[model samples]
Target chain A: MCRAISLSPNSVLYAIGSRSFEKASRFMLENGFSPETKVYESYEEVLDDPYVDAVYVPLPTTLHVRWAVLAAGKRKHVLLEKPAALNLSELDTILEVCESNGVQFMDATMWMHHPRTAEMRALLSDGQRFGQLKAIHSCFTYKADDDFLCNNIRVKPDLDGLGALGDIGWYCIQAILWAADYDLPQTVTSWHEPELNQAGVILSCGSSLYWKDGRIATFYCSFLTNLTMDLSVLGTKGNLHIHDFAVPFRENVASYYSASQFRVPIMSEHSVANDRPQEALMVGEFASLVVEIEGNGSKPEKKWPEISRKTQKVLDAVRASIEKGFQAVQIVS
Target chain B: MCRAISLSPNSVLYAIGSRSFEKASRFMLENGFSPETKVYESYEEVLDDPYVDAVYVPLPTTLHVRWAVLAAGKRKHVLLEKPAALNLSELDTILEVCESNGVQFMDATMWMHHPRTAEMRALLSDGQRFGQLKAIHSCFTYKADDDFLCNNIRVKPDLDGLGALGDIGWYCIQAILWAADYDLPQTVTSWHEPELNQAGVILSCGSSLYWKDGRIATFYCSFLTNLTMDLSVLGTKGNLHIHDFAVPFRENVASYYSASQFRVPIMSEHSVANDRPQEALMVGEFASLVVEIEGNGSKPEKKWPEISRKTQKVLDAVRASIEKGFQAVQIVS
Candidate 1:
């Protein structure tokens, strides 16, 4: 992520921070950080730096509310890694603090900023080409080795808590919501018998989201299967399929398939090239928002935070459904 | 179908039948059936012809039991069109009579006979390549125009009582079972709020199938969306995805994508060519079975009826779930 920020023309790798000074300095040296960059022994010191315009929090999910709230309270723009918080309540607290401080906030879901995403969005929104969205299926899975299953932060209850759903499923949920133009689903129901580790941390799970308008989406995420990332959206008039939506197979160009009405349907492959990686584009977009807020005296962009909040809300509903024996949990938001 | 049989060296188009003699004659002429083909005014007449060793029944769901039973009673091998029957009981009757009469029976799920399907099955069966099956998601949908939605036999409740669940979902369910090596799921639960026509026939619906071993499959079928036939199976070590599982986009060759263990997963595109369409291969296979029963006096192939029965059993459970307000239905079989 720091590398991505450095690659963005609109952003600078201004500072580095870790709990230990040695770790921070090592990260800087190994990652080729500029020698002139400030290094902080603690996150608070980085937040306290007045020269720093924005802070990106890549901390564990359990610490998101604490550090993000602190960063926002310090009036720094916040870009936090996802599973934004342990739940929506924590996310709400972070968002509230950011709003009170008039600081821009966004989650680090890089694919949302991909140029191909914008192209997909346009195609989905076009009535003649895509028509009304009917159903979506997204899957993100990667086989976790014994080492990862035993020690990864994602499988630790205190660090990520939500496990596979929070780590990779968040991207699937976000993709579904994005395809639906950020419309919140009416109900969410978890699939039966989600695979969980000995600690009761989820290793694999799936859920279905239903809207009143009859638009439905299903997603599955796992740490127990081969690496697979796919998103398929079916509409009344057309269909869209991406083999790798969480991350592109190649950094330079990403491809998806699209097909319209036909008795014998034939899909046309569409690929979009990127001068910079999607993460860099995400950083550039965030930096641009900060530039508008800090340099031009404009209000922070509400769209980014709003999207993040919606994603978190649905995440909470999915968790609730899983907790309630896979019953349908209504999304009040 | 006549053309398919004509293309196969081992099969012959011996007869055509419909309620009206003119309609049967016209169909034979339109399909380029050999002039030696017998045109019968009624199905019973064709079934009564001792020279005909087998009969393909393409009647609607409502007529399946009566005609199929009569065809088997006449000691003719029966190749039935899909939605084998309205429910399991009706299918059981047909299967029992076929067994009693010592005649082979097969459902015309043409894709199952495709060479590509065998290739996919081979990959799925390989423990090293595909590992144990974990999950599957299948979708088969096609936009039915206003005229067809109002007038097509598929939308008529009495003619095809199961509607989309029977017409398209039959293929999805079969694909899921095939991927799982024909293992019957223990429970099936329909998705909520399936779209229904005025006659209460389902226009669109989805369901989830759960097995005792924690393997699960979800499928969606509709007559209300753009054409999409996708079957995605994820296993512990590898994944298989076919966008056109129900029918190939082209008549000659079909393709699917596969990937196995990798940190940065890369998919290999596989295409299998066919000298004839899948339907022809299906007819050829069925005819070979019939020839064995007659020419070689071999006992009927048990695999075909066993697979069809299992597919129908699950189809019945899905319909039961829908009928019981989306509750999970247990499969006794």
Candidate 2:
């Protein structure tokens, strides 16, 4: 995030915070923060800084609710890390505070801000090219080394209870919703037998989402498989596929495959090159929204929060489905 | 099948039987069958021909039981098109006849004989590279034009009652079984709201397969979506994915993506080029097995029938689950 802010012209690495002052100073030095950057001994100190316009919270999932809610209440635009909270209700609390404070709220899903995403979205929305979405499948997985699997905060129930779903599956869910134009599914059914750690935190899992109109989406996320990031969206007349939906293999160029009609023995491959990485672009986007609200007298961008809420709602439903023996869990929201 | 036979050194286009001798002769001519190829007006006459070693039944699903059983009873090896039968009982009857007559029974799933499949199988079996199989997802779909949806035998209930599940889902179920090393799942649960035509034939459907050991597989097949064929198999340490799994984009060269361990962001893409199309290779393999039984005094190969039976059983279970309102259907076999 600090790197993104450094690369983003619209944003600044204004402050660093840690429980220990020494750690904050070390992080600042390692990340090449400017000498004028403020150093805080604690998160509260960062939030208390009157000059701070927005705060990026990269704390553990367990800390998201408290920190995000406090940051929003402090009238700072909140750039929150993903697996925004343990559940939807917690995220709702943070969102409510942001709304009341007129503060912009956006999850740190960098891929959303990539230029290639807009190009793909254009194809999906084109009736002649993509048509109506029928099915989608997204998967994000990485082989976690023994040490990471055994000792990482992700595997700790108290830290990131959702594990792979929260870490990587969040992106998959977001991609599905994005492809579906944010239409919420009626039910979420987790695939049976999610691998769980001793602490009952999921190490790997998958789920199928069903809409009332029979449109469907399925996703798999794991901490046990080789690195794979795939999103395949099938439409009535076309299809789109990307192998690297989360993080691009290369810094400057990203590619996705698309096919329309039946004239394909080979899909048309599209390569998108960007001047800056997606994270930096994400930082720029969030900062732009902040500027609109803070300087241009514009209303805070509701699109970001709405998208995040829908993703969280589905995530909560998936967790419910897992808890209910992989049965279909209705998404009331 | 005719093209395959022509390409295979061990096989011959000995004869073609149709209700109309003129139609049979026309088909033979169109497919480049030699002038000496025998044309029989009746299927029984072709079966009666002493020179014919095996029969490839590309008849409708409803005709499979009678034709395949008759071919097996005649001591001619049976190469049956899938869905092997409308249900398992019909298939079991045909299998019983084949076993009694000592005839080889292999479903005409051409991709199974592709050299690329064997290469993928080797990777999946390598413990150090792939590890334990965890999940599999396969989908086969093609947009059936209005004429096809209305006039095609595949949409006719009496001819192919299983509909999309039988025609395309057959390939998907087969791929899942192949990935799982033919281990039948304990239960099959059809996804809710499967799209059905006015005649009560499945237009599109999906299902999840679960095993006692927590292995999971999901597949979707449709006659409603644009052309798409995907098979993603996830293992503990590695993963394999093929976009054109059912039919290669190119007849000679096919590619699949694989990654093992942490060296990803770039999956190793492997391409296998075949001297003949997969169908020809399938015919070659089947004919070799037939030759072993007839010429070498060897027993008819049991492996082919076993794999076919497993695939049909799963298809039946999926149909049963759909019949029972998307409830879980146990696989007694």
Candidate 3:
């Protein structure tokens, strides 16, 4: 909802496509969209729209690669929902298609654009404050909706990538990776509840990721939990905690105390208006890219296949750990 | 010094054994003790004191069981420092000597006596407040002394029990066990950093304990960390957090938070005072046992050995997990 509102000013809603055109038109009209915005009964009709410069694909997880590829082949930039594809093969196919057609492709992982994340990264790197980073702990959990069990794409393994790990675990993985400055995990292990579903998709997962420098990162993600989102980074000198990295409006800060006499800071909400920005910033970056392409012909933005490949590898190892009952998987890289 | 002063009214300080007895005596005198307290030439003389009703054995960890057995033979109640003994065999020997001679043997694990602990426990068990207890998380850690490499007992495997597990990890283990009403842990796993003389002792440990009724408790304890002592218990209705369990004088309190609101009562300093009460209460309990032994010829204190044995079994499994590099160790009843 926030993304649509943010992008509406610069980008026209070319056409609203759903299973029913009447419902799509109603949604568009209710959101203050123009009446000229065409209504398409099928996704194919929207793909056929020559004026459509980009496609925001929010379909079920299983159809992401199919629609992304179709949109890219039609010379349209594509922004796909998380767990970009069901597996490595599908993600690779989408990447190949987008590259061959010279169209931009990006997984809409808004957490990466959060400004507080950038601040945390800078804080960890600053020797005076954090010193050498040693470990990271992260958790993202919330209760599943009632409809989650009724043919929901999130519960389908072939569609939703790998259950909880794909839905919320991906954010935790990305947080740890970015905080550690993209250090490749040396090994990974995971544990999950077994009674959830037939796809053996993990509903809850706890994973340990080892880095080459002997640093460790642990994360937990669950769909059967009372909502919680937290992150902690431990270093030699001090530590930083983000109670809710998803919406970091205020955070509690503490440093290592060295003296007996110290003043207690009044408990006040420390607001960083620009501290942690959300994925909506990506729309602005995307807008800049559009302007760059439309105004002056410049070199294209750098593609991130390496990051995608590494992320998929970690995801695969985490899933393997869950299948084997949290057995440790030695990461070759 | 606080522990020593508590015993002064009834027991004579026959000897002070240290690299410098004068310095030790000065420390005692500064804390409101008489300078006439005997300064001993050796620790053996203190153990040899016939007038002593109890032996306050706070010697380096390796000497705990040796002195404890010697004191038990001399017919003195033994107040031994924690990590009761290095292994099960030594603990058995200490217990056997005390039992045969009819002397009281106690481990100085005092956090359980804090009043706030009882308050927190009551709040958690109240069906209207927190409902059924589901999970527990705890941590206890502090910075190592500068000369820890050369002089610290914690670095020596024989003295410090294992490493962090024996030194500080025991506190967390005891906390979890107490919160669950002494339920036996069904499984355990741990991770250790052995380079810092942490052999058989985990620097960082994460374990999941499954009770018979499907309740799960998880904990983390580390020695290679800044000072922190906190516990959070999740229940069906709400959660209770006992912040700073180890240091009650330092603004520690019990907090209860439900889905909609939270409450934190200002705790009086004496509410959780640690000084004298732990030893005084335990001694009072033993005094009652002494009366029962003399009058009814019954041995109610016999349950202490059983509890100690159970604690030892869990400790052994945690050590095994560290040796196997965090492999899960199932506890067999």
Top candidate by DockQ: 1
Clashing pairs in 2: none
lDDT of 2 by residue, A1-333 (tens): 788899999988888889999988898888778999988898999999998999999889999999999999999999999978888889999999999999999999999989999999999999888888999999998878899988999999889888999999999999999999998999998887788988999988889999988899999998987778999999999999988899988879899999889566478889999999999999999999999999998999999999999999999999899999888999875
Assess candidate 1 and give its TM-score to the true structure: 0.99
Which ranking of candidates, highest DockQ first? Answer: 1, 2, 3
In model 1 chain B, where is the ten-residue run with the lowest total lDDT? Answer: B260-269
What share of the reference contacts survives in each candidate? Answer: 0.74, 0.68, 0.00
After the best TM-score superposition of candidate 3, give how far the Cα of residue B126 lies from its true spot, in angstroms.
4.7
Candidate 3 lDDT by residue in tens digits, B252-287? 333322320132321112234334544454454544
Which of 2 and 3 is the better model by lDDT?
A: 2
Each prediction's RMSD to truth: 1.2, 1.4, 5.3
Show the lowest summed lDDT stretch of 10 residues, model 2 chain A. Answer: A259-268
Give lDDT tens digits, candidate 3, residues A1-333. Answer: 333424534555667788997788778777777667788999888889888777778887789878998998997777777777666778889888877877766677765555555556776788765666666767665556568855677787777747878887877887787778777787886643322566666666667787755476777776665454556666655555554665442322211112111112111122344422354555555546655655575434655444555666677788777777777787666
Prediction-by-prediction clash tally = 0, 0, 4
* iRMS of each prediction: 1.0, 1.4, 6.1
Q: Give the distance in Å from residue A75's predicted Cα in candidate 3 to where it truly belongs.
A: 3.6
Predicted complexes: DockQ each: 0.81, 0.71, 0.21
In order, the Cα lDDT scores of the candidates are: 0.91, 0.91, 0.63
